[model samples]
Target: MSTTTQEAFWSGEFGKAYSDRNNWTSAQYDDFYRHEWGITKTQMNEDCLRDLPKDAKILEVGCNIGLQLRCLQEMGFTNLYGIELQHYAVEKAKEIVKNVNIIQGSGFDIPFKDSYFDVVVTNGVLIHIAPDDLPRIMSEMVRCSKKYVWGFEYFASSLVNINYRGNEGFLWKADYSKIFQENFHQLQEIYRKMYPYVSASQQGNMDYMYLLEKQ
Candidate 1:
């Protein structure tokens, strides 16, 4: 599907569905990361903050409910900013992290100056975007970061078909090494194992946490 069509579909359907109480819950969010993604707040903090300089400026795309923001704060990261599309999630985030500078915006159109952040982080956000928008969004990510860009995303060799909540489409996976080489040098890649409880249909599914430094 075209980018415009995909954006419209997501803005209306997936966004609303996820923001709905019946569709999403705080417990589900915690469980998904802890059980499904195999992430802990400590691990998330270390992964994002280790290479970053003290008091570095950081931006997180599609940061839901500021869970990671709390983690960043615990790691002594002060200059943190985030962009999230869902209003409900944004509101919840504000309640948890009062000092966070969270903006309601699209990942493809981040509202920040070029090279404004020392690091840019995103987790599980890329899967929601349509395949065609990936390049543009990635460019935006590169444009905003001065030093490094870290991402944890779901991967498949090619686009994979999935159906959920009246939305059906293929999620694309790019050759990260190839793509990063075009604009940055890869520093590290940490692969996270898939959870056992995930459906067999999602077998072979893996999450990769990548760290890239601008060339």
Candidate 2:
């Protein structure tokens, strides 16, 4: 089977091992929930989220274990869906977040009709995509969303590569928002913010959150 490097890395034994290590205990639940909650608050204020139709569909790409979708569901968004590349993660997400739909899939080809969702979003996902293949991933995301696209990823003013767990090509930081605007002529920037570097181990790491609306 022809697979991208990502699919090969995240779908085998190593992927299963990563999945096994991905669960959260009760002790860590509060922090995780709070983090996602804060993002929802920001999304609401920036994207006119409160004014969206009650049943507006939202899909989170790379939604591992459904933390973001769970937050949306808890925050009263009626239609929530997530697509994950890891089967173990998808199973866990479905078991835990029973109210939301979780599917095992990839970003290269989102298995949904064009404009099927009101918003297509991803948290820390785009940075992993190889730049040569980024346009395909970005187009697939925007194609699935009827009105908006949201992204939260490590951001830099220019493209920068970082070693992740000793892996050379997996992680990167870049001006993702600018990439968005450049790729789509009608995309209007609604919000952009660089979060403070907070992780103890990755001291210099910073994340950016962006919400863009299509005109």
Candidate 3:
């Protein structure tokens, strides 16, 4: 596979298929989160982000259909922005999320100036990136955030590749928070939570969420 094969796979027909499969309303998203983690996505946000001002500028990198952004918006966060690699998801997000900026953009090349956003985030996005390219994309998140970098992703004690829809080189799990702290020493981790899946099909999987502040 090419080093950047993930970009093609996630920007083309497969990406559209994934978006259609997960095109859920805010309520549907909350229900899924409640089933998986016993709390709504909004509640998770509130737990991690209660310290942020309601008007803080937040950007979600690789925000597929902006479900997470919708959750933040529901929590009274006024300045929400999202960058999605898939054009189809961008359009769908525009249709679904009111008053939020949803744009087609890549995580490797976030089209924002340094410190443009109060917080930069990703939910379930980093796992799809190639391991060698992770630092570059994550650096973009750090470069754009004025205060915080947050992520929700699959977790493993070490890096491990997983077959995604029978496709190799498409998914991975790692101790993402540790990697972030190691790679960017200036950003200190402020919060973290781990939730093991309660849903039957994914019972063995654990999801991790973390918040890092620029110090």
- TM-score for each model: 0.76, 0.86, 0.96
TM-score result, candidate 3: 0.96
lDDT of model 2, residue 94: 87
Clashing pairs in 1: none
lDDT digits (tens) for residues 1-215 of candidate 1: 12355555655545565545433343554565666546654565576457667689989998867877766776688898999876767787787777889988877888899999998888766666666666788888888988787776666555565565555663445444345455444333342333232445555666566667765
lDDT string, candidate 2, 6-116, tens digits: 667777766677656756643355455235443333343335455666678999998878766765676677898899998888998887686788888998889999999
Per model, how many backbone clashes are there? Answer: 0, 0, 0
User: Which structure is stronger by TM-score: 2 or 3?
Assistant: 3
Prediction 2 global C-alpha lDDT: 0.77
Q: Please, what are the lDDT tens digits per residue for candidate 3 over residues 74-110?
A: 8899999999988889999998788998888888888
Of the candidates shown, which would achieve the greatest lDDT relative to the real structure? Answer: 3
Q: At residue 139, what lDDT does model 1 achieve?
A: 84
Taken over the whole model, the C-alpha lDDT of each candidate is: 0.67, 0.77, 0.90
Off-target runs (Cα >4 Å) in candidate 3 are 1-3
Q: By lDDT, highest first, what's the ranking?
A: 3, 2, 1
